[model samples]
Target chain A: MARSTLYQQVASELRRAIYSGDLGPGDQLPTEADLMTSYGVSRNTVRLALGELVNEGLISRTPRRGSIVRDRRPLLMYPQRELTPQPASVPREAFGFAVSQEGREPSQVIEVSIVEPPEDIAIRLELPDGGLAVVRRRLRFVDGQPYNTNDSFFPHALVRDSEIVRPGDILRGANRVLEELGHPQVRVVDDISARMPTPAESSRLELEPGTPVVEYVRVGYDSDDVPVRVAVSVLPADKHLIRYELERR
Target chain B: MARSTLYQQVASELRRAIYSGDLGPGDQLPTEADLMTSYGVSRNTVRLALGELVNEGLISRTPRRGSIVRDRRPLLMYPQRELTPQPASVPREAFGFAVSQEGREPSQVIEVSIVEPPEDIAIRLELPDGGLAVVRRRLRFVDGQPYNTNDSFFPHALVRDSEIVRPGDILRGANRVLEELGHPQVRVVDDISARMPTPAESSRLELEPGTPVVEYVRVGYDSDDVPVRVAVSVLPADKHLIRYELERR
Candidate 1:
């Protein structure tokens, strides 16, 4: 038991190091010999400790890099319901659409355009292949630091005819544009996933190497159950956090 | 337009190569000279093309390795509601517990174990700060391949005094265990995020570079609205899909 306890201790220390940014993502960990010398443990013990961290989604070992610290960013999910307000009046101060209300107050800058979407996106909007759709791509920022990127698609017919569809402020957000089109979202379905950040995504979101990102593919449907819009957002896991609430009936 | 289009083509080809395992994760890409010779493109064009690949999360470049393909394994998510039997009546299977004649087949693994959870988990379960709890972990396999991992926690005192708290099979599942303990799950809340897989996650889920994953933190509440169990699951996004239904009054 005492021998195994040492392995746990090593794991805890390594975890703390990674969390504290002493070891950045893709930064090579000390070799086994170095770890043994530093921690005064057998190679087997070090391997066991490393294995536990692997299971918990921490450090990753490459053939050449030894072990690199995995990015431990918290996954962030912007729930669709948060974007879809009820029919009742909501205070303007309560609007968290374009910016984080408190704390760091992350704001966003976006470029919205009505373009001919690709086949996959066109299908989502129930538009013909090569048909035009309003595609809004936003480069989100948390305290002026780029945090995420969002791309949303809607049938052009719905939004292009609206006054808000102009490219000048295309990124006011998908929901706001939807409101102007009178297809207020009544329901939303969110499909989420995570992966390593793209180099561009890494830079845009200021992601570290070996860090994973979360993607939320949300489809908003109106009262008639017609899917109105589709939005895909990729977020770096280490920075943002996702929270949910469940109530008993 | 054609000049830029060619680079997009090159990027897409490399993406397919990575996904199809023609270029396995961690496998180095052709050197600039080699790529230039192979693709009949200038050095600048190849670099620009590679730049786009990095942006798309398809490859990673190291100081020495240049560029290596990413793991492209998708995360899988099994909905929490799917586990709840729509047919309330439990079927009497080989074990004392009930099984249903469902559309899908359930494996015959009598997997169950009870142990103390980690510190972070204890806080999530709200286990009275150092209080003991029954921590059960199992990997659900379908047709001999691992599908998902299940880990559940219960207050130690509640299950320790019961017959279901054995080291072997801990009352089928946490839900059944709770039902047997007379505190059925009355509510469930799930928070989800998606991102690219880390190297470790890729190996565990048989994913490759760019393969996405969905991380879910699910909390179950009992009839009294008290938190009962907290489960954290990572699903491969490619193989698993989530469908949710929400209705308005």
Candidate 2:
């Protein structure tokens, strides 16, 4: 019992050092032998202390390179910016635009299909019973690394004739296509939560162990208050930061 | 390798059942012996499958209860509501009001202290070098269950003499005191991110294994654009959902 407590104490001290920037990103932790000697603990206790850090997503350990602190600089996301009108010269989607502004390349692979949506999504869209929907799923990447996913569903009857049903990227964005279809969304409600990734999500996003994902869902409504679209995004917690700036009316 | 794949396949089937509501919350899964017989797998594989479900926060296991699905209904939070003006008749803070509306009792224990603030918070408040601030920290509960934490910091020079520095709950909230001090916030910026909780946070919040937390930071600026307050909330992702309603002008 005392040894278990000692390991936790050692882990806490190391964590404080990392959070205080004394041990920065890409910085190497002390060798196992060194840590064992300094803490005056056995090799097993030192390994257990290091293992705790690994489970916190604070550092990664490898046989050849030892343990190194990870780069935790998250991508700042301005969700409100999506509603703002952008200059005509900028003809890119929000994710790509945000990435480019940071000098990082963004890319995605999209797959579109028509099917009966999930129960929760159908409820959000207020679709009639057995109503079908067009779903566009995207696996997005940052600088060629898979970063997140976006899956958007629209009432099939409302968007069957639009480019949303077609393939490839919507260079001008699907929102414009919705406007062209005369179903422009005038309002949206966003719900945000976080959870551990399933095995499939972990492999697909190439996430490190102990990393969690934020699930953001947005339901859009047209001027008539008819629900139009439901977009769900799964963001790796370590790589994304969401921001909102508000002013008193 | 085949056995490993078999366990994952079993875990996936159970997961689908849970997500599809075929196995609702508080429902019990088949006994390990039954599962082994049904899937034609060894007892080891059955345990592995159940372990996966536990790790996903979908179910819990014990010597007596076996395995039961977890209740995942999260409390909805409307963060934007805080900025809107409230009627004089309602003399409660946002969290308490929201909880009461949901028919749950809300309470908190607050501790007030004055000290040199953390670096990030000091920067958000735009405090000069070596400046101090007053922080009111609260550990809130709902229906007698520990919920989340809110820590609000104000520039010492701005509210050193105000009620914010006094220990105990603020009946009307610290924002009202700030207004009385002639530094009403005209604008605010909110930043949200998620991460695995540190050991200290995990114990204080009584979080389950594999649970993550959302770190929400808000900086309020007065008419002169000088930041006067910075409030940070640590929300357990499993029990809270944040919502934002937006309308295009």
True contacts kept of each: 0.36, 0.70
Residue B211 alpha-carbon offset, candidate 2, angstroms:
0.7
Listed per candidate, the RMSD to the true structure in angstroms reads 16.1, 16.0
After superposition, candidate 1 runs with Cα above 4 Å error: A1-99, A168-173, B1-85, B89-114, B161-164, B167-173, B193-213, B247-249
TM-score of chain A of each: 0.61, 0.72
Give me the iRMSD of candidate 2, please: 14.7
Candidate 1, residue A176: Cα displacement in angstroms equals: 4.2
Candidate 2 per-residue lDDT, tens place, B50-112, comes to: 776664567888779989998864667888888887687888878888877655678998999
Interface RMSD for candidates 1 onward, in order: 12.6, 14.7
lDDT over C-alpha atoms for residue A188 of model 1: 69
What's the TM-score of every candidate structure? 0.62, 0.74
Q: Note the residue pairs that clash in candidate 2.
A: none
lDDT score of residue B99 within candidate 1: 14
